[model samples]
Target: MAEAIVDLVAQGLLDEGTRLPTERALAQQIGVSRGTVVAAYADLADRGLVVRRQGSGTSVAAGRRTPVGRHLRNDGFTRQVSGPAVAIDLSLAAPVYDDVVARLQANTADVMAAGAAPHGYTPLGLPALRHAIAGRLSAQGVPTTAAQVLVTPGAQGALQLITAAYLRAGDRVIVDTPTYPGALELFSRAGAQVDGIPRDHAGPRPGHFERALADGEAALAMFVPTCHNPTGTTMSERRRHELLAAIRDHEVLMVEDLTMADLSFSGEAPPHMVALAPDRIIAIGSFSKVLWGGLRVGWIRADPATILRLGRLRTAQDMGSGLLDQAAVLAALPQLDEIIVGRRRLAQEREAVLRAALTEQLPEWEIGRCDGGYGLWIKLPQANAAQVVNAALQHGVAIAGGGVGSLDDQHLDHVRVCFTLAPEILVEAASRLRAAWQQVCADDGTTTILAAV
Candidate 1:
């Protein structure tokens, strides 16, 4: 029983603070004696793996202690820095979906009618959705076919499949330094020796990839060139060509995460890295940003053989994603161009609002502008991002510390603030953040005063 619990925790299915099932319920479910369950829980507790409250049951322990100013918890999960009923959650980059919800509501009948599949199972996803996605990709200059597309639950699932299919224990994988936390967690859990390459506004440099590959140890490289998370910078065309040259020269496999591809508010994106190196790059994209977050539809675009292999591997996990979700996405694809236009306009406006708010409220902070993407990366005047996060939470605002997005805990003076919220909320959140910063300054015995920019 203890082993089973440990496995779940390791798999991230059971996150920290998640309460273990009651001993009686677990014993009944697993057909074990109550005393046996009790013993297992006690053993876990004795090993400092969990904490047992007198009347509250067993919960995963906060095992590793970190410096008060660092946000990276010893446990992988982002620590909840907010008080109860957080007023504004800037920590997450979840897309706002008021427009998407209205569209879905209007198309519900058509979506339902199309989802009436005879078998109700599509291991490779519904044919129409695949064709639609391929068409979209082709229009974006990637030149794809339905046969090369494999739909998954979301971008995360697509990433999981790619990592499981290609990576092995101790294999070296190169990723951007301030990459997505979920990707870092997945790669680490897969036992890959993940390495980080520093990134600038142009994205990860070709020189870094060349140097990493010169060691002849890296088997895989991952990139989020377009609308990079946390940083919100897109790669320049020159950088893309250089990076593609390095990938081809090194004979290494590349994973291109295009989850934010459609969310670009800038002009047309440079050619997709996958299109430049189709034989070596596997592209993953999702509609969660362009559409609604509730729509868990995403796809992997690769060679036909790779798609087939990933599809087969997927069957062992689940039959497939839901038919209704696919149908809904299919129904919405024709309007994708229109949808993206509205979304980009709103995102750009929100980004401007967030930038202005921060400039006016926190003038001492260094803020970078993003041509596209949903968040801003801010360098704090102080190095205690975790303290700022906790302070903001006390003022009813929640923000993410930079360590959550970094692999080596090197971004201690940075924080990621998403601009996806409504303008009024952004205003309030900025005010709360300013209050928090002042409180932090006061606690640190700094005489720095907030000045309106």
Candidate 2:
């Protein structure tokens, strides 16, 4: 296997800086022993074909030392497709409706005309869009105002601003055990010590929350109270109160990501965390899930002081979000309900189809709660999620391993599959996943199940 990899690199098939799969995943794919794969990787490293880092897995070494992005696989998922083009990619969970471009294009003329009128920079966001976002949040029970909202390039940009403003090196952050990989990445890059609280169906346990923050040194606590990313477990109203009480007791500032809140299957969710404690909780929202990821429009709702602090950081990063994009969002704001309705129906239907297919094809696997959200979390009977992910690529389906969303690189028996694709495509993806699971099973005899912490 090492010789084959060397040959591929020599032939320019394996590009430089490409990450290689873990020993177990490669071993499972080729039906080799883990020890043999380990030795193969060791040989590759010795021959300077691959570079091995302690935390980061092995990657093809560059000829000369060059700085790389601080956490390239921060999404917790790897996209190392070496063979044929992938048939289905479930790694990114975002809406990609056909009419999205048409909708945005319809507003281009007016938006451009408006953009041409000014210096075209609204550092805190266009006033109209901010008002619309505030109104939208108020209607959802947050009682927000334009003065408290700062438009960001996206929810991710909002996170970056918040982190830049508040977090410092060695500060502690509280998060769910298996949470958004993006948040994990940002926090890790900022050199914060992340402490993940174990979660159940109801959400993070109040007791654990109290304990994690008991030291009172935690700078922030972040939660996806509605339509959580991989797990899809929306915190119940009761769970919300319990956690909020703990936050109050600890006097800890909280960040609530409502990016997936609007996609609830029931068309109803608990009040925004900001609504319950407006002063303590900062809210991050985006149209990426409902409108389109390319929209690049999201907001941060917090106290005016906090918004101002973040705006200063934002201005340092970039002048502001694009005026045209904000105007386009303003054009779509009035039609948000109409768009959300279509998005909800699509998510519900596709989720059902994917669930049915997975149930029929891989009944032995356990599907986690998915009350709302783009992805479904699956628990396998064995701790081979990485192996299955690698094998799935060979079958032309790309899925994320459990470790993608985990704080401690745990949840090895889990995998997350997005359900935003068409019904037929989802069915085909599930079939491919089953085939991959079977391949991994046949390749290895061990069946270790790592119970969720």
Candidate 3:
């Protein structure tokens, strides 16, 4: 029992100010004697890992030290890939929004009239919008309530609030490798030690999560289970269950980013982690993908208390999300079902075009079929992806190298290309990419050989 407490503390699982279970309760849960737990507590206290106060339960010691290191900043990578302003930019994951923009434009009058407050400063967001978002989530089986919803400027803002509210400088955050670079940057900026768990084609393995929890400390785990960014992979329902179980057992907070959940082309939306572990998981969502990036509406769904705390944190940052944007999203929510159907169809068509274009132009590249999301992860056989990105830019195309999306620089041979563009543009981008590849091979003084699929 003493070893368990130490391990939890070392891993950053048991955060400061968190009360431990009573000796009797802990002993009962672990099938150990009360005296054994008492001894364990005494040992932990002696080591200054925990503090036991009279009438107050044992809690982890504050001011524990954690090592800090510099991490690759996502914004820097974004600027590197997007700064040149190429004609067809595949470096960022902006969604295709022609249809949604038209719909919103047609209803602009209704959205403008829906706003009750003239000044448009809603610190906790528009109540009507919160209710609309909550209703949509509840319909999706997440069992959310309006009071538990807090609107933010975007999913990135919601993430900032969450990290500010829950994470301290020395906390440990576990994230999957090849995750959204923005998320990695946020965690690193928060002064948290970011640990990466390698993922497969399906997603992060649940068994790896269990091992990570047992071997290290984590204050929270962030997952993009549905239509994962960069890789465009979705987690199987069974894997989500296993991962949720691990989170429950370890008592670590879970942050689920569902920004691309509605854009799934496979027509299969797995049960939300919040549905299974409402008290533990805080889900972040945005309208940037389904509706329009310019809208900049996003939200957080969690327990009411957590929502309240996040609201306060948000209030401290800026007054609140734009009321006009909130009203626009509210006006658009009723049409969500129809909108998603169209978006999914278009996404599928785009995916197909991207696949064929890559096959025709860069036959040596290994690409996976994405069932959802906006991008394709292409593996280069020989060329360095960063070098390829630079070369592609010179050819008037921009793309994100895999190392830009990963916690470590492990995926140097891969690149992520966004397909959320017009078919003609995608085809042109692929042609330019091939040119970049040939240039890289020439620079390396190596023959470019196409690999058999």
Candidate 4:
């Protein structure tokens, strides 16, 4: 079976690049049909646990890292260096809160004194943390209860739980044309067929969504309506109602991501989709964007039945989220509003600096307007985004190309740059990015030059 091979690879019994036995031979040895073995090998290949070649047989994969590790390493969250000794990482969209560690330390004594679980197994999340999450949602107009909340390591983890519980192999998933890369990867890993809907700055198009759901091909839809990731476009209240009407007629499920909702530059998030249709929407939120990514605290709010089902699925995977993480999130809840205010101000200031720098250095590029969120989605004039990204790395700056967030690779001419750094760094990054852009253009037989910034 696929799981047996996975266990062998995980336990180091089957080394990386080890050649797997031929399907027929293994099938005969194990006394199973050759067809069953073939299916198992196909499943392993799909999960990236094995590699299949044209002439060579299947072999163990080279590296099988966790999703979080892969995300951080491959998605520009971690600054990778090759040519430069120091690289300015503009890939991560997370805000850096300097005092969060101290705040967590200050609350650690109380958390410890109150006594964490002896076995540390709170499957549905710590009671106090659940209540705090529920209260936070209630204040946001969702009217949630602790019984309807389930905690996970982060928004990514919550998505994993939902995918495991609700999505099955071959299920159809509807998403935006260029949505969160992590969500797209997760849904694909669950073997779901992804379909995209076009957008025009008002979030996903409602008619496209309705049509996609009309055929009953899509089992569920994923959306980031407020301060949407990569694009930073918030859906208008009218569009929200339109989508709700579509969902009502189609009776399809929706997964709403509120990860970056609270980071709005206006210091106020829009009304949650779950508020309009709690029974139909499964909402995911995280303290990673608001408090700190290191806290690894996130929650899900849904009907009690869905919550319980997800909780059981989460328990089966890992007993529960870390007790200390839950405690830290609970401690920070009281002052979360003030923290969000500071973050919004910081994002606004940094975005302005980044925009000014990009305008001065890469004047030909089209900079998309962002009302909230941490990054700018930029459209290149004539150069390829992937080439520019590579040249930027050589110039000591790291950024993400639009293909990283695109579902169908249609955004190859664009890039997403985070403005979470200081003003001076933003200015310097723009200078380096300009040089990279020029290099890419020149490589493409275009002679372009720009004055020094």
Candidate 5:
């Protein structure tokens, strides 16, 4: 038997056009039987990979040949190509990874080693972990029970479960465009129509949501009240009340994702719209940013009946989040305050460096009015963000470019610079960005300016 089979094209180590040696040649060289090589080929065939033809040798599959920097079709829409290898990266919105994550992962493995594979499916989740989560939420005065909390893989999974439980094909789900990119994909996969409302700087545009809901067919609306993504805007308390009243009047179920709330740079959080309207809201919270991305632990706060409905639908997706991820998150919660403090420090320093650089170097650029969140949404004097990003990447810096920042590509001239890099890295990043911006300005002498004055 062969010892192992490797993905031949994994790192371009096996170049796309190159072919592996014949099974007889490989077996003879490695001292393994041809039967083993045959088993390895069978594994490759099972993966929908490789092409085999009668009287012809096998060739590389079509799947692995996707261009290294081509547009990726993720959820539904196709995203533009983002060049890899950069001196600076301001494209990703994720928090920086550090030692705390490693420590938690070490602890997670210890627990799993204790008792990993139990009897048939711990579907609802590990009981001790669920109880810990419930007890934690109750401390927030959100009125949760262990039975009311169903641990999904992430807030993403919880959202899917809720959509699966409530929606049929062709039902309309409301979204604020420039909303969470993943949620847009989730709604698409569920076969639900997304009624995208325009978003203003402070969450959804006033009365825009009202018009979308006017058609009584809208069944659900998802909102990110605290630390809304992309724009770094939060819905005000007054607007929160208005949003609740509007959704209640329309009888629309609200799904609020508070994924980034813990990183609020302002330290001020509005009362969760969910807390204000419990009967109408399904709240999803995550440890992805607060703890670590690999943790992938998130909880859903819903009615007990809603939880039971989710439990039945949960098996269709995953067995539940891994037990050790839950155990690690629970262990990390008491130290959660420490983690948040470290994160706040990192965010504050990075944002300050970015702000200082923008003010001193590129003073003419328009930075949006943001009180909280991890990204800086700024507009160039005349540069097309998409074009600028292309030029900037070639010059050794990569910035996130999209009109998807605001509803309907309204900010097509703008770029979103994520400020979640480590402090030292962020300083060097800003220096490179200053150079990139200069190059972008040089490349755009013919373009007319979009003047705010």
Candidate 6:
């Protein structure tokens, strides 16, 4: 069996850099003894088919193209797929649709039927949809009409449109450190220098942000005022008002991202900053969470002049958001309260399960007190989060978090474990994780790094 595992890798049949199964999982899959799998790994290491690092466990050599395994197939194609086979996908912050999803599906044809005209290149958006968006924002507090709304494909597109309009190369932008990773990447891609502001449990650190603004480099700031990503911190109204006043004084553009705000995990939704500082805030919202993600729909509520600029940019990017999706989301808006109630109940239940499970299984680690959102940010005791993640992957329990940068001292200690997985898979994944931790912290040197991190 050991010789067979080595022979498969030697033949260039498996793709380079694909994850391999754990000794236990491989043994079960192959109907062989766990000892046989360990011997197979030892044999493979001797031939340099894989490198067995002390802390990192095992991985294929960079040049190795294949491995000897029943799963390996050599039909060369550029079809790259990456996802976890674990029972629960606690990785992505996904919301279940249930009634909302079915209702939208049934009424999708109605929307298409209504907007069944030649919408080839209307720059701003459909008048009815824009009006609906404007109405929604006004209801939320940032009073606006259709003239102030510019519909985009998604929150991402809305971001790009705003960035293109106001940002340029060498421009300085202020962002909260460890905020949405995707938005951070977008800022970098748009050619701007990003300065991170320190944030606490309350909200963005006002002292740090004011200092950044005082530096006179930053002309814009992006913030998540409600249920921030990863941390799940909600910025208090007082804190938001102070920040907005500072932005107003500094003549800075404030971009508000409220994609997850509507989830209302705790029934206390923070006031939208756009309501208080409508003049300086560019508010972006999306239906990806409330509705289905497949619908590429999101909206921006800004000053009419800003909307005009975004309208031209929207024309160049892509005509407008899907008419069908816009209609479906409009229909779901009235049912928004019902959806939030169900989602919050489910999220709370999941959180409770996760908290109890962590207490019973991983007593040493401290779970973040995030009452909202899809996952928990766990602080492990003497464990490398990334090292643990790579190890967990082989054990068939995929997690989220990796190295932030080459120079970053690994953030493996702060991993975000999603509670969205089912109970059985969650238990199995946690148990397998306990097993992986033993291997990761077994050695003195790796254990030391784990301690320091």
Highest-scoring model, TM-score: 4
Against the true structure, candidate 4 reaches a TM-score of 0.83
lDDT for model 4: 0.81
lDDT (Cα atoms) of all candidates against the true structure: 0.79, 0.81, 0.80, 0.81, 0.68, 0.68
Evaluated at residue 104, the lDDT of candidate 4 is 66
Model 6, stretches more than 4 Å misplaced? 1-87, 96-99, 106-109, 112-117, 120-123, 402-412, 443-453
Q: Work out the TM-score per prediction.
A: 0.82, 0.81, 0.81, 0.83, 0.75, 0.74
List per-candidate RMSD values in Å: 7.5, 9.7, 13.0, 7.9, 10.1, 12.8
RMSD to the native, candidate 3? 13.0
lDDT of 6 by residue, 1-453 (tens): 643444454465544555568888998997989998888788666645677766666777666432121112211010114442554345566665465577774254555544434644556666667787888777777789988888788787788888878876557888776566556555554546567776777788888888999997675799988877766667888899888878877888889998878766777776799888777788997877666666678888888888888887777777677776776777677787787787777777877777776666667777877857777777777547767766666666666652231012334466777766556666666777666666666733453222221
Point out the worst 10-residue segment of candidate 5 by lDDT. 67-76
Q: Rank the candidates by TM-score, best first.
A: 4, 1, 3, 2, 5, 6
Cα shift from native, residue 268, model 1 (Å): 1.8
Clashes of 3: 1
Which window of ten consecutive residues has the lowest lDDT sum in model 3?
Answer: 65-74
Q: What digit string (tens of lDDT, one per residue) describes model 5 on residues 322-415?
A: 7777778767777887888778667767888787766655676778866566788788876477776767676666676645433334456777
When 1 and 2 are scored with TM-score, the better candidate is 1
Per-prediction tally of clashes? 0, 0, 1, 0, 0, 8
Error of 6 at 365 (Å): 1.7
Encode model 1's per-residue lDDT on 288-356: one tens digit a residue.
Answer: 888877888889999999999999998888888877778778878778788888888889999999999
Which residue pairs in candidate 2 collide?
none
